[model samples]
Target: MKILVCISKTPDTTAKIAFADNNTKFAADGVQWIINPYDEWYALVRAIELKEADPSTVIHLVTVGGADCDPIIRKALALGGDEAIRVNADSHDSFYIALQIADIAKKGSYDLVFTGKETIDYNGSSVGGMVAELLEMPYVSLATKFTLIGSEAEIVREIEGGEETDKVALPLVVSCQKGMAEQRIPNMKGIMGARSKPLNVVEPVAADTLTSIASFDLPPAKASVKLVSPDTPEELVRLLHEEAKVI
Candidate 1:
């Protein structure tokens, strides 16, 4: 089985986000970036579990970004990906990013592709579905469990008010989320091995940008909390009906 995992670079959760360049660009000055933690800890690691079960399985990681994303890609290589491919392009839009990833997956002849449910930064969970649509394959999203059964995948996921399972054929895309597997830390051996692994950088194919960010601004702050005396239940009810208006 050949598993292609899509990885993304994201700002560390603790980073203070801000915009510059007339509010049209992200301020990267003094900001720290990391592999999208959910992708690393859940999706990629779960795919590695499948690799461990089958020695012939080969896991490849791909990312859409510039040279600045290389170090983190190398770190993903250390985590377990046998090879890595970087689409040399600015991931300016979800559509374009999906196109780049889909093209690479097609060229690689990947049997299965995995990506985090969404990137922490953009929170756009569209890649897997887009790839599946482009490739004419099935896509299972928010997959919590994955097991191979004779060229088929037994996928389990949660649904509203209940859980559901599906058996999808091979050559499918899965957008993974939490509870898929335990996180795996990159050890010394894997780190050393990553240096020797193949890291391929390729120019993006001709693709049109379908969307662009106009500007970014912080969300409005929450309203100040108002305290109500607990001893006066009638007053609290009155407040809920009047000032709070939540009744």
Candidate 2:
């Protein structure tokens, strides 16, 4: 099976986020970049596990970004992806990224496409579904388990109360989350091998972006906690209603 894993470069969770251009652009001055956790731990790792099980399976990593994202893609390749594809484009919009991925998948004739449920930066879970719509293939979101049997696929997805399992045919897209597979660390040999692996660069097709960022703003500071006496219960209620707006 030929599987394409969509990877994203995101800032480390602990990085200090700031804005430039009068709050219109993210400041990348001292940020540390890493692979989005959901993509690395679940989606990409599951594909690598599938490859380990079946030697014929091939895994390729794809990312929509400029040359600065090459390091992130290389890390994914070291984890077990056979090769990498970097789409030369600005990934400011989710639809533009998905369109590029759909074009690559069509040209490569891949049977399966995998993506993380959401990126940590934006938390918008829209790319995989958009790619599926563009490719006209079956799509499963928030998949926690996946099994391939001949030409059919068995998938388990998280629902409201519990889990739901379904079976579908090939040429499928799935957005994965936790419970799919355990994360793997790249060893010395794998890291060395990744240096020589093929890294293909492709130009993005002409497509119009639907949205643009207006500005960036940080959340308001938290208020200090207040201490209330147990004897004045009515005062607490009044404070909740007027000050906290809880009632």
Candidate 3:
């Protein structure tokens, strides 16, 4: 089986987020970047597990970014990807990124494609679906469990108030979340081996960005807590009804 896993670089969770250009752009200076947790912990890890089960399975990692994303791709390779592909472009538009991935998937003729539910920075859960549409393949979102039998796949995905099971054929796409697989840390051997793995950079195909960020605004600061005496039940009720607006 040939599996293509889409990975993305995101700011570390602990990194302080700030905007630039009068709050119209992200300030990336001094921020440490890592593989988006959903991509690393769920999507990529699940692909690795499949490869482990069948040594003949080939796992390829692809990311849409510029040269700066090399380190993040190397880290993913260390986790067991056979090879890597980097799209030589950068865009915040989800469609543009998805187009690049779809192009690669087409050229590679992968049997299965995996992507995280969303990227941490943008939380735009649109790429996987768009890629599937572009490739004309079945798409399963929020997949928690995926099992393969011969050429068919049994998938369990999260849905409204419950989960749903799907049986799809090969050459489908899945957006993975928690319960897909546990996280794996790269060991010394894997890290050393990754240094020798091939990372191919390819120029993006013709694609137009459909959206642009107008600006960014931070959420309002938290309001100070107001205390109410236990004895004053009326005051508490009044506060809840009028101030906190819970009632």
Best by lDDT: 3
Positional deviation of residue 179's Cα in model 1 after best superposition, in angstroms: 1.2
Candidate 1 contains a number of clashing pairs equal to 0
Model 2 compared with the native: what TM-score?
0.92
- The alpha-carbon RMSD values of the candidates against the true structure, listed in the order shown, are 1.7, 2.4, 1.8
What residue pairs clash in candidate 2, if any at all? none
Candidate 1 lDDT over 1-247, as tens digits, reads 8999999999998999999999999898988999997788877898899888998999999999999999999999999999999999996688898899999999989999999999988888888899889889999998888889989999998799866999988999999888899877899999999999999999999888887889999899988887777787798888889987999
Q: Could you estimate the TM-score for every candidate?
A: 0.94, 0.92, 0.95
lDDT by residue for model 3 (161-240), tens = 99999999999999999999998899999999999999999999999999998999988988888888889879989988
Clashing pairs in 1: none
Task: Report the C-alpha lDDT of model 2 over 1-247, residue by residue, as the tens digit.
Answer: 9999999999999999889999999899989999999899999999998898899999989999999999998899899899999999986788999999999999888999999999999888999999999999999999999999998899999999999999999999999999999988999998999999999999999987998899999988778889799988899999999998999
Estimate the lDDT of model 1: 0.90
lDDT against the true structure, each candidate: 0.90, 0.93, 0.96
